[model samples]
Target: MSGGDARQISVRTKDRNSEERSEQLAPPLRRDQSDSITYRSFLRVRAYAVMTKPRVMELLLVTTVPTMILAHGGPPNLPLIVATLMGGAASSGSASAFNMYLDRDMDAQMRRTSGRPLVTGEVAPRSGLLFAWILAVSSTVWFWCLVNYLAAALSVCAILWYVVVYTILLKRRTEQNIVWGGIAGCFPVVIGWASATGTVSWPAVILFLVIFFWTPAHYWPLSVKYGEDYRRVGVPMLGAIHGIEHVAKRVIAYAVATATASLLLIPVAGMSWTYATVAVVGGAWFVGEGLRLQAAARRAEAAARPMRMFVVSNAYLALLFAAVAIDTLVKHRFS
Candidate 1:
């Protein structure tokens, strides 16, 4: 480069850096502004994080890890596990962010979601949509490079299924939104299994079915609790469309199916006594909670029973997956 041109470029770079430093060193916000720009930036980042739905991703990771262990017949390579989970998080987060963007209108109307980033104006819609697409593409590439092609494809399908199928097509239109739409949530099992073995096996299918059956049992109670919020937003959640009694009945039916599916994993996967015991006992407790909620619904009682059922269902899945991991490790260690 010519000397004059190089000098101009250097001056521009220095000026940019100097401006950044000045901004960093600037005194607290002016008395009129009340809040610093830096603090507002931090909150914007946090709001973006909230758009990812961390709690749902945590439960997804819980299922993914155990399924990977079962697929490997023990704990898999630490680095591979980490890479797969990172990709999974990115995929799920992208789907959630897109859902937030698409549902922001309804979210604004619902009390439960009124404070969501887009709804609250904490994150711009365009930015949220761009973030979602970026994560979606990056996660697919991440899985293909770090895990396997099959895992990557499944991860992409998961995001597509949740965002396109569920969020766009099903959520607002049907009461069975979560029933079939919940299939996206169950893909992590097959993705984890494929990551470990590079193939989907019967064991993985069984676990997938377990999650599929468990979804209604686990989520319907929360739907019952949030029926009014959903109704207010014109979202057709089961508990919003039908009364709590009908929701409770379906919850009991799905609970029974979930319990049966959990037990079937023992025979199909040859899971050990630890898993068997936990599956049976945990399944029973989960169903009992469902029954309690059903009875309350039948009697036209308050919402407490359904809420209790929701809490127990979380514990139920956690314990069952925990037992899967523990049992796999125990047998692998002893053998």
Candidate 2:
């Protein structure tokens, strides 16, 4: 063999090595493709999660576990509590998704709700409705199996009341929408008590009233801030129909009623001193803020920032429920 034949063999060897390197690079490209697919899937799931109205679900769950503890007159079974919360979350999430689906037209008109999954087209309307239905059915089954039939039934009622009674029949037609519509938000207390003791009683009923009365106070100020949004969408929210003075006045009245109703829980539930004190103090603070809102309305102060009451109302309810759990735990430990 000559030098030329040797060089030809060297060139072929280099070509084979290059081919091997190309094959090695292919897996990284495939891995990148896999990663891209996973990220897209994550975004889709996150959009569905948003449709669940997680913030509202968190608040609903906040009221639930404490009621269970108080119902047991102590800390209840941990697993039962966890399972009940999971079912309740699914129920509430389904209701919220249904609301988003039903209200998508109005949601599209309002700046505040314009970014919701349905309104933004992140999830299709049909898909959202199906997701809600699936969750509604599964959550009912979950509660029946994990908690009790009564609790399961209550969960189902909450969904129906919210979707059918509140969203479809009442919202667009009545200024009293939130008044009656808000009842759906009160079911968790009864469900919590029923899950714990397998029945509803005076204590559960009293707590249910507490939340029922608190809803207007909790939600109206936010409505006050977004009155124009409601008006633009033809929603009859209290703030949309009434003047600021009337809305603020209603908030004050409801605040007082909410505080008064909370006190009933003391005698009825045998709630501890800590709960009584927090209820009285938190209720006073809430009512005071409401009074200030009304006074601002009287003064015609455009920049009164009614949203302040909206923020405090959330804190007030959270504090009251926290007091409920702490009081029960304290009594359990000391008594």
Candidate 3:
């Protein structure tokens, strides 16, 4: 009786083990299954990243590093550097994603924007907003812990300025949208400056002003070319509302202001003579290009000329900052 019972129990145990092994061989997320847990999770993450505006983050982070180098008077605090970068990235990224969420309807209307991941249904709007919220909260906490309160506060201001004020309010309301909204991009400089000193300074304010003045001209040329799209979408862009020719005049005016501001920044930055030279050459050239674009817009011929002006304006900003950085380093070493 005992032997018979023991044999039956042994067979049952072996069967159970075989079933367990078979289950193990069947992966939780099958490679061939498109609906597998891993694949869906990855797509969700990728879509979220796309919404966060990587290009904007690239430029913003670039600004932070230079500010750090200049602020420390040489080698920066390594931990502060990493923390500041993470905070800046997360804050900017969150704002960008939120913008996608807010502008989903407008994006669907414009041909240029209709193909965005959110508008195209590549990413669900809810998921995009959730991602933005998570990132923004986490980033604020991160900066608060790593940097001082001033830096964290500045980051929050940047997010609010871009998402709420610029994207929601200004973008639809007035052509002067970029004029007031450009403050979003200007925050990184202030945040970077504050990260070093933990307080806003006149130099940082000057940097803010320079970027602010540069923004309208920077944007208007593109707006002029895309005025039709903007009009179709019911966006009150300068070019669309005021007319391209008139907007072109404003573009030149902004460029004139920006060039003047660029020259002014050399002294305000407490920088050397080399920076002064870049300002003189860069500013003059910048103004000349603006005038050319203004005339081109008036002629109503090849719009390509105005487009070139836009490209040159971008080059001017990037190079101007780089020159300032290099010149400061050089002069410091020699002096």
- Total backbone collisions for each predicted model: 0, 0, 0
TM-score of candidate 3 versus the correct structure, residues matched by position: 0.84
lDDT of 3 by residue, 1-335 (tens): 69999999999999999999999987685367567888888876777778878878866765677666666555467888888988999999999999999989888888777878898787888878888999999989998888989998999999999999999889999878999998898999889888988888776777677778888888887787777789988998786677556766787787778777767666666777777787778878788887776676677745636677778878887777776667766756776
What does candidate 1's lDDT look like per residue over 1-335, in tens digits? 99999999999999999999999999866554327787778887899899999998977778999999999999999999999999999999999999999999989888889999998888899999999999999999999998999999999889989988999999989988999999998999999999999999998998889889899888888887788999898888987888777887888899889899888888888888999999999989988888887777777657446778888988899999999999999999999
Q: Return the candidate ranking by lDDT, descending.
A: 2, 1, 3
Q: Where in model 1 is the C-alpha error above 4 Å?
A: 1-34
107-130, model 2: which lDDT tens digit per residue? 998999999889888899999999
TM-score, candidate number 1: 0.89
Native-referenced Cα lDDT, model 1: 0.90
Task: Give the winner by TM-score: 1 or 3.
Answer: 1
Q: Candidate 2, 326: how far from true, in Å?
A: 1.0
